[model samples]
Target: MLNAKSEIQKDTFEPASDNLSERSSILTEMFRKALFRNRVQLVGGILFAIGTPLIFRFGFDQLPINSSALSNTIVGSIFALTCGFFFFRRLIDYPGTEGIAYAIPIFAVTYGATVIVFLFLRLDYSRYLLGASYFLTVVWFTCISIGMVRLRTLRIGIVPGGSANALLSLPSVKWREIREVSEPTENLNAVVVDLDHSFPTEWERFITETAVSGTPVFDVKHLRETLTGRLEIEHLSENTLGSLNPDHMYLRGKQAIDRVLALLVIVLLAPFFAIIILAIQLDSPGPAIFRQKRMGYRGSIFTVYKFRTMRAEQVGSVDDRDRAITKAEDDRITRLGHFLRRTRIDELPQVLNILRGEMSWIGPRPEAVPLSMWYEKELPFYRYRHIVHPGISGWAQVMQGHVASTDEVLEKLHYDFYYIKNFSPWLDILIVLKTIRTILTGFGAK
Candidate 1:
């Protein structure tokens, strides 16, 4: 019995030793990772400084044909490198619009760098669109890159109680510490954090030492603003978005172009539209022309029109219960209706909505007034969308798919707000381009 006990004790002791060593190594690696993340902005600048722009312009123009072996290898390697970099770095957080928002600058920088180099290296660079594009691209890229780096490192992540929620989203000490508060009933900007994991001795020392000497710590909104290049509204709270004013929101003149383009579209597509109406009428017993009262432009209601895609009895008319949500493969859809809806030909009459003062070409998709009534009460800043005229196509429509429920509407509302805040001509161009692309892709069609 004594011999057996001695052997067991030895075994236990060996594992404990191994556990300590393993922990030490893990801790060392975490420290290195944290430091490396903190230094990304500095490193990005250095990498950018080496004139990546010039290299791209030369290489891109001369890039061999797609069928060439060298072309295939280089393209494969480049794409692989980008994917590896993003995936390994966890550069993308949430997918969909969130992912797109984060990635925009990365592309801008990649192309922009080539432009900058061309301008600096070539005397004739001023005559080309490349240099100008580079200049434009860099502004967006640098701002967003700094914002992301700041977000990752908590550099500009926090404002006076305004740091982004992403820091808490990260798998870090702060993430472990923040728990959902049930009792207080008040949203918090900052909270005392605790962790079962031991704090790094170096980090503990660094925070205690340097944090006291007037270096700023972040609030969530600060980081979001930095990352998004737009001031973010605060969390859902009693005073949440109290300062938010609908009048403060603006979309640029290019949106007017969206309106004009929409008009032109109606004219150009008029014959096809006539045929669609004929088809809808022939396919279903219901009227081809359907008009509904939709809320638009600061709570005013207007008659919106569409080609009826549902059977006369199966679908609700404008005056019917006003339950606007439609499901995928809904039984209501007629055979021809399905095809029309999928291709968005049913929405052609919205060009009339644009012509009429009720809508823009690209803004928020108008909802039924009764539904807006419920949403305005349920979702904070929901009415903010009404600040601008409703549009036939919108940022949310292009960036995300249809909203089937209240949850989806609220989510789409965030994208709408983001668009409202960053209403520039460039954004409008992108939205229009994307709208055309969507019409081609049919990704979100019924």
Candidate 2:
């Protein structure tokens, strides 16, 4: 067991001399404020990355202002740089340091879109200019992230009592316990307290004053959810924040977009799908497509599709509940099935489910009918996950993949609740980026 007070005292930094410390503090604050400001980072990125290149290319008379090359360069550079910048900013707010890992791929997607547009329109553009912009954009953000990591240490003040001590176990945060009402608060990034716990009058007054004095106050439960990307709900009413009720408008809009994109993906990947189907058939004597009943959108039953990676004969003899659980090194998985599952090629057919409005590109992954039924019986409010459409790639899938045991599923439920509670474009974008990593690295596939 950890002693919260001792741990916090050990982590706190002590100053040397009053005058020397004051001068150093002033300089550090000024540097931190300037460097960490979003506007400063944006302006610096645009000027150094986009503006410098523009000056050399067009300002030097090497390219005319009205020329197609000049226009394409401006449009493409600005598009890639701005998109990458904001995407990085949003992702950094989520828990984890892997936000920097996404910088390259985000730039790649934005720049690739520009190239695709230029090709389709038959417009003349300097490939070298766009490529350089992509490179510079990535380098700029990466450097800024590294600088922030080195310069910034989050100092969060924890109010002693209740479950506040539970947060001490979390890493990368400077935890300072507020023992006295008179404890200094100016240096603290935020104040964390267990809102559920009743505090004495002095501490209560301190919390009120802390909030009114401009320092942010956070409930320990919410802060932990933000830091860990998991939401553990002991009761249905614990979701009183109405995070249980996601943006209805976004949900509807997402479904429409999912349908259109699903159709487009199917159309574009038709030939590739044929190749996979042929490979599967050649490897095993079974139907190329595997269909299973799954619990989907709002507890509805739907048939989910996947490329058959398992032998046909072996699947029927097992019990439905037992068969639904894919154990590690399960022999039922054929040689090709292992590769397919690892790369998630087997899930490609779920585009059909998305087209049918039974699923989305991202949300909670649906479970097999038998498994879903069993879980709903064992777990509290399990059907609440079906409130949103089931997804192909989701928070739980990326965070803790391919779980089977009820204990593991309990933890997976927390991830799902986090997704449902914080359901929005940012979380969805994070899932998409993480899913790309999952595809390449096979982090969570069975």
Candidate 3:
């Protein structure tokens, strides 16, 4: 148990462990391939960053004439690059006007920062320049947003059976432009067929022809993974689990970075931490900190910490499954507790866990021991997420929001598997940024 807990405390820049040496050689190639896969977006970002200021300078001399052209160009360039980063990094391309909503906050911050800098320098501010830049950005981004929606739209034809029904029912389908139909259409971008069930010769020919034509044809199970960002548990097998080769270098580096970041955040938020402690103590009779045994890396059990958000209660047995899950309207939550959970102030104490080497700043969230034991019994390949240290925030938490109940856990596992298989610094960065949005919006909080 101690060995497992200490895995995180190891030097970040050093090789992970003896166990990882065999895999390190291939890990770099895999990450290089994944991170560089979005080369078009990368190139586009650079071009826009360099080109936007020049175009604005030509069209509207709103830029401060006295300031160096380079200095005047910095704000708009930063704003464009920042927007493109978050917009293009998403795994699921949100469709339609709703997709634009995601960029609003990013724009506000970057643009606001630009204005603040101008005021700080007491430079001659040009309202025309600011307004012109804003107008040009909206027009530019609107076109790109439409293109993104169109690109995400996949005209999929699936035989009516197996995973088809479930795929159609998911709310997540709205994130992409997917249109599933019973019959194969000439315009289909892809085709999904269940291998378990037999289809007519005509259907087989349609699938074969689609493949021949270079339109991608996918197995129903693989399509589920692609669409939902989770491994489909119903079809999970040993072969699938065995195929996962986690990048040890990336994991170790992420851990080192997480610890350093957690320490810095803890130091910065120290004043807020004291205020929270006092509030929790005044609002409830229990201790300010709550700790419970959670399944950690390699199934090691460790105590996880959080601010107390419920009334004082005795610890229960591992078999106490009924009381294990936190419900949406749980009455034991105090007035301050409700506020804490909504804003995620309740989780601030977990920085200690990160510092202690039991958790990362990002990964699969740890499940309580009782809940973990129950899931192990109920779900196949449930323990696979424990391949890495549990996290304070994770892919599932940001994408699916807070989950409860067996059905939700099953769904959450899909995302967890996706994270495990696709682990990269880019995905972790996305999770962290989205988590901030989730916290501010009070999304999925009871």
Best by lDDT: 2
- Give the deviation of candidate 1 from the true structure as CA RMSD: 14.0
RMSD value for candidate 3: 13.6
Q: lDDT per prediction?
A: 0.53, 0.82, 0.67
> How many clashes does each candidate structure show, in the order listed?
13, 0, 1
lDDT of 1 by residue, 237-346 (tens): 55434433333324445446657877889789889888887888888787888777888987899989888888877667444434466777788788998777667777
Candidate 2, run of 10 with poorest lDDT: 1-10
For every model shown, what is its TM-score relative to the native structure?
Answer: 0.53, 0.87, 0.71
Ten-residue stretch with the least lDDT total in model 1: 6-15
Measured by TM-score, the strongest candidate is: 2
Compose the digit string of candidate 2's lDDT tens values, residues 218-313: 888888887787886878785444768889999999999999999999999999999999999999998999988889988999999999888998
User: If ranked by lDDT, best first, what sequence of candidates would result?
Assistant: 2, 3, 1
lDDT of 3 by residue, 311-336 (tens): 87743444577766778888878889
State the lDDT at 65 in candidate 1.
44
